[model samples]
Target: MRENLTSVSSLNMAFTDSMKPTDLSADKKGIKRKNWRRRIGFLLKTNSSQPILRLVKNRSYRPSVDDVNQWAQSLDKLLGHKYGKAAFHIFLKSEFCEENIEFWTACEDFKKLTSRKDLVSKANSIHEEFIRSEAAKEINLDFHTKNAIVQSLHAPTPTSFLAAQKKVYSLMENNSYPRFINSDLYKELCAAAKGEGKHIKS
Candidate 1:
């Protein structure tokens, strides 16, 4: 498993090496200049190929008892915790609906853009990747919402995808969240968190 992750990491590096934008720089969050493309691509490849093995391999982001307890409280709480979100993303992948979280995550990052150029470029990218019909990882969006985003791309803003993001969030909250709460992956995480030291919050 470790060997697989290392190979995936290497492949991602090779895939992204020639594609880095010259104008890009690390963000305040210390995210490297590879930005979303590298991550999105790596996630799609890794999740689709090795859902279970990837989870067993990556143990650096161990969850705390409070993290697991908070995750059970709400979808937002779960996403707010880094490890919880990562776990849920894996669960979504295993169910073959990871695009919902992928699109949601892209929008969250999109909202943090301060550069007008970046806002425009990323809005169009998001539209192409997740909004357009037959998009590679398209989410289930209504025509009205999808058209609205298309119309706004020429003058995109930080909130360009706000409506669409909310819709996806609602979809995941209603559908995936319930399943995740009862999933073995989530239960295992809860158990692991408990084993860390303190009793899990009931």
Candidate 2:
């Protein structure tokens, strides 16, 4: 159990509070603060969700209203968006279940390898880190899926981890995804996106 974003309540507060406009504008410090806010606002208003880091331009990233709304619609929509995926990852880390997403992402990356050598190496690494009996970040898997992955590792193919990956994805979708949707972190994000003033820092 690593200390995740939510575990640091103060940092989480700082991130959510970053969305609100600062109460300064009379002195040089105030002027600088306003400029910083403007720059960050500009970045958030961009069409793409590329800048989803909670630390916007150093200390924050605000998802647009659309982004937040779509996340609530389905797990697919949430994971499909880069910002959504990043936010979910942070949420999962807080829950100490980040291995699910991590393994899924590794499987996705593994599928893109063209060379057999690269596939074999990555396959073995992913297995040792995640699929082995006592892996570093072992994920929940049925005995059948686990053994299947072990067997496939010797002559790894792009889909070698497909079943295991699907299982992990299903676990997140059924368990963590719902919790994430109803989490304080998510509520704060929604508030920031919908609130008059918006920003984030962590």
Candidate 3:
């Protein structure tokens, strides 16, 4: 059985390799052949890994307003992933309060940097744009948090934005988050997800 399975896998690999395009010509025939090869290769790869890929693809499912609401019921669920952040951003944009989400997202991304140069550069950028007074898209932060960020800027580290980021997070949790849960947009999304008419409102 093991030998048979190995032989089948080798055959599948050989078939996939045979479909790869060899010619790089600019003519229609060459282009068509290349496209055909790519399509076949894609189909074979997807077919081979369908079970695992299905679960990964499902993670990317776009949530409706009701889905968002259910997620919002848990703070960790709402703030844990980019999907939640993106949904909140859309809602904030509609409400003209997008800066909060923007600042929060920037902080999240900033923490993921590995290079010292990038950390310093992004920290300064975040401070100038969101934490600095009279700056465009300035985030609402208390003096203590702003002062700590300023101090961190003098000797910027990966955690330089921690204080400010926390403040923005708390602001969203206490303020915009609740409003988003109850907004007309959330209701519409929930209704749409349920296959109801788009005009339905909560």
lDDT winner among the candidates? 2
TM-score of each: 0.69, 0.71, 0.62
Model 2 weakest lDDT span, ten residues long: 14-23
Candidate 3 per-residue lDDT, tens place, 1-202, comes to 1112112344233222221123334563444333333322322232343322132352334345555566558645776744455445555644446788778779889989998888888988998888899988798888988988888876677788877778777877888888767765455445545655333211
In order, candidate lDDTs are 0.68, 0.69, 0.58
Judge candidate 1 at residue 178 and give its lDDT.
Answer: 97
C-alpha lDDT (0 to 100) for residue 93 of candidate 3 = 47
Quote model 1's TM-score: 0.69
* Candidate order by decreasing TM-score: 2, 1, 3
Select the stronger candidate by TM-score from 2 and 3. 2
Which residue pairs collide, candidate 2? 15-201, 19-199, 55-59, 55-60, 56-59, 56-60, 60-200
lDDT tens digits by residue: candidate 2, 1-202:
2222233333333223322123333563444334333333333544433344433444445678999999999999998887778667766655557788889989989999999999999999998899888887899899999999888888999999998888888899899999889876676667768874545432
C-alpha RMSD for every candidate: 12.9, 10.4, 15.7
Which stretches in model 3 have alpha-carbon errors above 4 Å? Answer: 1-61, 64-66, 197-202
Which residue pairs clash in candidate 3? Answer: 65-189, 65-190
**Cα lDDT of model 1 by residue, 1-202, tens digit:** 1122113445334222332233333552132212322333343332344332253453323456787889999999989876578767766754558789889999999999999899999998998899999998899999999999999999998888999999999999999999889876566566666663222221
